[model samples]
Target: MKSILKVKNLTMNFGGLRALHNLNISINKKEIAALIGPNGAGKTTFFNCITGIYKPSNGDILISPKGNNEKINGLKPNIITKKGLARTFQNIRLFTSMTALENIMVGCHCVTKAGVIGAILNNKSTKAEERLIIEKSYFILKELGLEIYVNELVTSLPYGAQKRLEIARALATEPFLLLLDEPAAGLNPQETNELDELILKIREQNDISILLIEHDMKLVMSLSDNIHVVDYGKKIGEGTPKEIRNNPAVIKAYLGEEVV
Candidate 1:
């Protein structure tokens, strides 16, 4: 299968501080890849670059849907999203006042071509879009086991439920690839398990590729088909979960030297 997303020699710098350095990553079509590292590692920086929140100072980011060799590095976030890339942040970013269903309906706005006037007038120019959006959003809510809370105010839901709602919002965008930053961050064991299952189901049902940056090693190892490790702005290792588990470099980076 073709590569859905590609990053080569990616670097992000803030003044003299380099957050990501010469990072190279590639995710194939319909695959799930994880980025893992120590707390100060450049995983989040790498994510920002890919999602267009940070423009790479040097390197290339390519997406296949728009054809190869197209430079996507410096594109704006919304532009990149329009090109079929979508993401959820490390923190839940919901409209607190909106209901769970409304949060998802907002995501559907990007893919729908209805202009502000069309929406205001409720014109036929957008009726079909609105109908499809409602059906798809409801379907996504059901897929995430969030149907029961669809009408509840987002702020009133549990923390984990709020996070899952964020995922539902991203899926509503109809993205070809999804980037998840620590979706399991604040969840309990049961909630984590549900998130893990839902993530896999997303790949299976939507055929969407995923790039996840997560601190939970168990969750990362279980959900990722491949893993990349970073340390202080640079990639130190990349391999299967088993390989990463046994790598001395990875252990030392995360835990320092173990006294024998």
Candidate 2:
């Protein structure tokens, strides 16, 4: 299987503290991978580094959207998004004042070709692009079962729906690889189950690879084809769910015991 994203010997430092230390991870095309560990284990920091929220102090962030590897470290966040990577936050980051539809439209900015001149002139091309963006955004809402909230303010939606909407907005960016930071956080059992289904649906229907940071053992074990365990900013284990479940280090660090 070909990898869509690869982080090689990645390291991040803040003053005297190192958040990540030579950590490496890879996600294959169409694969669902998980990064699991205790709090402050550097999972979210890894996401931040890859998504351009923070530049890595060392190592390469390589993206192969079409089998051609390109180093993406130090690029702007929007540039990375345009390079076919999109991510959702652990905390929901929606446009509170914008409707669900408008929020998604904001995501379309990276992919849209209409420049400032085109927008100012209101040319045929710009108008056509705007219309297409709206159409595509609405389609994504429906795909994520969010069409009913299309015109509703994001703040007005329930927690689970808002979580799903954050994902929907990421999808609006048309990513080949989606990074989800603790996607199942703050969800009830039913909502987590629904999220499990929704993630699989996104992978199957959109042909996109997924990498997530989640603490929900059930969801991680069921949804991930590969699981990587990290502790104190260092990798401790990497394997299929079964192998991770049985790994002694993983047991000692995150799982606490063998998963039944």
Q: How many backbone clashes does candidate 1 have?
A: 0
Q: Lowest summed-lDDT stretch of 10 residues in model 2? A: 251-260
Taking the tens digit of each residue's C-alpha lDDT, what string does model 1 give over 1-260? Answer: 67878889998889999998898888888889999999989888888888899888998998886446567889999888888888898877899999999999999888888888988999875897899888988988998888999899999998988898898898888888899999889889888888889899999999889989898888999989889899988889999999999988898898897722
**CA RMSD of each candidate after superposition:** 1.4, 1.8
| lDDT of every model, 2 decimals | 0.88, 0.94
Residue 222: error of model 1 in Å?
Answer: 1.6
Query: Please, what is the TM-score per model?
Result: 0.95, 0.96
Q: Number of backbone collisions per candidate, in order?
A: 0, 0
- Badly placed stretches (over 4 Å) of model 2 are 255-260
Q: Clashing residue pairs in candidate 2, if any? A: none
Query: For residues 69-104, could you state the per-residue lDDT of candidate 2 as single tens digits?
Result: 999999999899998899999999999999999999
By TM-score, how accurate is candidate 2? Answer: 0.96
Stretches of model 1 off by over 4 angstroms after superposition: none
